[model samples]
Target: MLDRRRVLQTLAGLFLSSFGLGGYAYAWEPAHQGVTRYRLKPARWPEGRRLRLAVITDLHVGGPHMPVARVRQIVEQTNALKPDLTLLVGDFVASRTRRSSDPAPAEWAAELARLQAPAGRFAVLGNHDWWQDERAQKELRGPTQSTVALEAVGIPVLENRAVRLQTGAGPLWIAGLGDQEAFVLRRRPRGLPYGLDDLPATLAMIRDDAPVILMAHEPDIFARVPSRVALTLSGHTHGGQVRLFGWSPIVPSRYGNRYAYGHVRENGRDLVVSAGLGTSKLPIRLGAPPEIVLIELG
Candidate 1:
């Protein structure tokens, strides 16, 4: 008995409601924090010593999407967890498109320096960091001044290198790898020393007796890693950024949804892919809200 006009109006109303909800989710839902906790059991881990690691990555810290205040909050949250180590995988500065970021990299690093990790705070560059300033980066210099700024704040960026830290149990080796596709965006993707990963050199530094924790921005590296190395941590997918019904339509990586988010077991190697705390490209975050990952190693 309903008229055609009435039915059409009803459909329009439903469509508008759906659009508004999506808009709200994109704008505000991402602000909701999701803390993912996990236990990492690596080979050669001492019986009594416990290591807690907090992984924070893909922090496109420019623009209103991830302002300085938010950065401070994230740092504070990490500190509150009292992790023994904090690994900051890259993308420190926002691209030119995001004009609202204040306090810049130095200020951001300063806040990060406040991070207290008895083991240490280490970092590596993400693709976004390398591509933030295309002109300067295209010249093959480095990740620009962000590295210097990070070092100034006492957090060092590690690239295909391993460092030994004396933990309560014993000595633990932590290695940081470069972004696999960092340079491809500037030029043609090529062989080793290609700006992203340097597995051979990085693994060479690991001693036979020491257990290692690896840091990589993209989770694709997880597949190639060896089981001798206990756990690999990464955060590039942003948990698909906006997932629906527990699945996101968009995930930026060569591996598709395989390494999208959370903990994954690949080739018997444990990988924790963080759902990072900041958004990229868009100001929206839905199913995958921002998070500060706390990984406990026993």
Candidate 2:
């Protein structure tokens, strides 16, 4: 048998070794790039009403970073959640600086179309789509091509339009706005042809009492959204792309990190902004992991 001093020293060394190995394993392992789920508890949610919404955005497909495998993984994970509504918040392709000869990035839309929900799947345009190649991107809506890829599979694209949902409780309106950042950056006369200014008018068109859920690409407009709208789902900030010390290093938006990522409350409107599955500008992430936000509406 070993002496007490010898045994104590041996145990100390083993403890240190194990701790070091564990730390290194955690640090070296690829950042957990998977979808994360969240439950949103609203103050006035109607009892027995459950609306599970999965929001995906900023998937800059066709790059060394995101690749096809990662995109598929995101889709699989999303479907696993079994959300009632699957909202594709845009940035499907990164075409701004890519060339025509480059492998078409729109193919991912077909992959995304596989995502199914009881109610339906819907999508809207993001700023990157317009900046990259509006014409080629628009091809996604074409029949022969992948334009209607999402819709072809079953996910309908909602561009500055609204859809009426038949919920267990009653009826709710789901509307999607076109790319707001594109118009904002372009200094266009009108941000969106039908925007916050015409929200009341649009609501008048949709006959529903369960409240309206707006799908805008970015959360910057959350402040301007009417409180009566209830909730807004968006992506595009990529949760600041890279996070540091639990905060995004740089959130590329006019609102900065305030509305950078995750769930944020602004002007009494609940907004869930996904960090996104793919990377943009860079292929690495620190504190910010790729995510699938499970928004629960009661």
Best by lDDT: 1
Q: What pairs collide in candidate 2?
A: 95-132, 96-132, 140-147, 140-148, 141-147
State the lDDT of candidate 2 residue by residue for 30-95, as single tens digits: 234666676765544566777888888877776445666667888888888888888888877752
Task: Give the TM-score comparing model 1 with the true structure, all chains together.
Answer: 0.87
Write down the lDDT of every candidate, Cα atoms only. 0.76, 0.66
* Model 2 ranges off by over 4 Å: 1-32, 100-106, 134-148, 183-204
Q: Weakest 10 consecutive residues, lDDT, candidate 1?
A: 1-10
| Span of 10 residues, lowest total lDDT, candidate 2 | 138-147
